[model samples]
Target: MGGYGDVQMIDENGLRMDGRKPGDVRPITIETGVVPVADGSCRMVWGTNEAIVAVYGPMEAHPRKIQRQDRAVIDVAYNMAPFSTTDRIRPGFNRRSREISKVTKDALESVVLLELYPRSKIRVSIEIISAEAGTRCVGLTAASVALADAGIPMTDMVVSVASGKVNDVVVCDLNKEEDNYGEADLPMGVLPNTGELVFLQMDGDLSPEEFKQAWDYNVDAAMQVHKLMVEALKGGANS
Candidate 1:
């Protein structure tokens, strides 16, 4: 978080600086089967954060050692485009992107029935075309959609979202400014139907009550985001 502490992010009406309630997430749009060449793909836009995910797979695993005898391995690469931020980010694997990619792969492996396809691999590539904040969550959420589009069997889809505290108030789906200047951040990946968590992470400071509020906000946001995912898959061909 930034050191700009005096920036007030909440008003007396309990509304956030962006005019949303404490639990309200920004607008979201999702589309599936977007990349023609990939076996499956999804594009999602949350606020100004845009991510595209491509899935290729159950193909023969390569480089012998990485292959598993009982299940397919998931390879994920999370990248941010040069033009995706206010300051251009150089292309390559940075620490932040690498960590996010690892978490994304882990989250996906939890839901996908990988053991069904031994000696195979699944590649999930996430490209951030526009990043506001929570790009990793958006990428993970879209990856689930792409897996579904590919007709891969899974226990359930994961819906990811972030919530944070700014000006002593809890807010859902932090934008770029809030993310940089907020007091705390909690991101989680949840199964919409079961309310089970597959991914979790937090940073900065928050009291117990504040933490609960953030978790609740993420839970509520995930359900709404799931609706968009369903719509996007239905409109895949048209999109």
Candidate 2:
């Protein structure tokens, strides 16, 4: 939390600085097939954060060591462009990106039917063009849509969302300012159909009650986002 002593993020009416209710999420827009060269692709904009995801393969897993006999492997790379942040991020892999990539791969692997494509590899590339916090959630969610756009068989789509405590109040879909000053954060990836979780991460501090509030907020927000995901996927063949 950054200098929360004097700054006020919530007004007397309980409205946030952005004029949203505590549980409200930021505006979200999604488009599919943004990358024509890739087997499947999607672009998602959530609040000020924007992410593009491309899915390639289920092609032969190169190097015999990487291939699994019973199921395909999910390879994910999460990267932020140099201009994605206020200060130019240096090019190339970094520790933060590596951790995000691993967790994202784990999340997707849970939903993608790897057993269907034996001895193959599915590559999911997540690129962040603009970031305003919650980029990981945006990347993972967009990747799921991109995979579906590629006609990949999956039991369910993953919907990711985050909720955090700002000014001692639990809020959903935190913006950049809130995130920097927030006391705690909990990000979750939900299976919209079954209410099951494939991803979960948290940091900072919160009481048990506050934790429950954040968890509930993320689950509810996921359902709302899931509707948009379904709509985008059904609108056209490319999506």
Candidate 3:
């Protein structure tokens, strides 16, 4: 969250500068099974953010410590491509990417029937080819679709989104400017069918009312995103 805060991102009409009605997310597009070499894969674009995810295995799990005797483990690697931002991010592991990967892995593990594939591993790789903020949410959501495309059994898919405050007004799916100049940020991974949360994070400041608004936006956005994910999987089957 940005504390510099000099930008006005809301208008007198209670609409965001991007014309969203405080609860509306930007357009999203999703496509699954995009990488032929991988077991399953998906690509998603939300606003200007784009992410691609690939899934592999239920194969033998490596690294003795990471293996579970009773359940399969999920190995997630979330990375931002060199050209993902206006200023390139040097490739390789970093603390931020590591943390995001860990959290995303945790979220997916919650829904995946890990016990069914003992001594195996499910690998998820998320690559951010373009970013306009909220890359983590996009990555997590895309990973779920890729896993499903791989025919992995799971309780439900995960839908992710972020909401925040700008100019004291809450908004859904904050864009680059909104995120850089915003006052708060809340991102979540939701299971739309069960209305349960698998991931959550927050920073900056939000009043009670503002927090509620942001939460609502994330939930609504998850439902909208879930539809796109399902459509992507269906399209993948036909192709």
Candidate 2 per-residue C-alpha lDDT over 1-239 given as tens digits, one digit per residue, 9 for 90 to 100:
56364668899999998899999999988999899999999999999899999999989998889899999999999999999999999998699999999999999999999999999999999999999999999999999999999999999999999899998899999989889988888999999999999999999888999999999999999999988998888874323
**Candidates ranked, most accurate by lDDT first:** 2, 3, 1
- In order, candidate lDDTs are 0.90, 0.93, 0.91
The TM-score of predicted model 1 comes to 0.96
Which scores greater on lDDT, model 2 or model 3?
A: 2
What TM-score does model 2 achieve against the real structure?
Answer: 0.97
- Over the stretch 195-215, how does candidate 1's per-residue lDDT look in tens digits? 999999999899999999899
* lDDT, model 2: 0.93
User: Which segments of model 2 are wrong by more than 4 Å?
Assistant: 1-3, 236-239
Report clash pairs, candidate 3. Answer: none
| lDDT per residue (tens digit) for residues 1-239 in model 3 | 76676777788888877788888888888888788999999989888899999999988999878889999999999999999999888877699999999999999999999999998999999999999989999999999999999999999999999999888888899988889989999999999998899999999999999998899999998998888788778884322
Which candidate should be chosen as best, given TM-score against the real structure? 2
TM-score of each: 0.96, 0.97, 0.96
Ordered from best to worst TM-score, the candidate numbers read 2, 1, 3
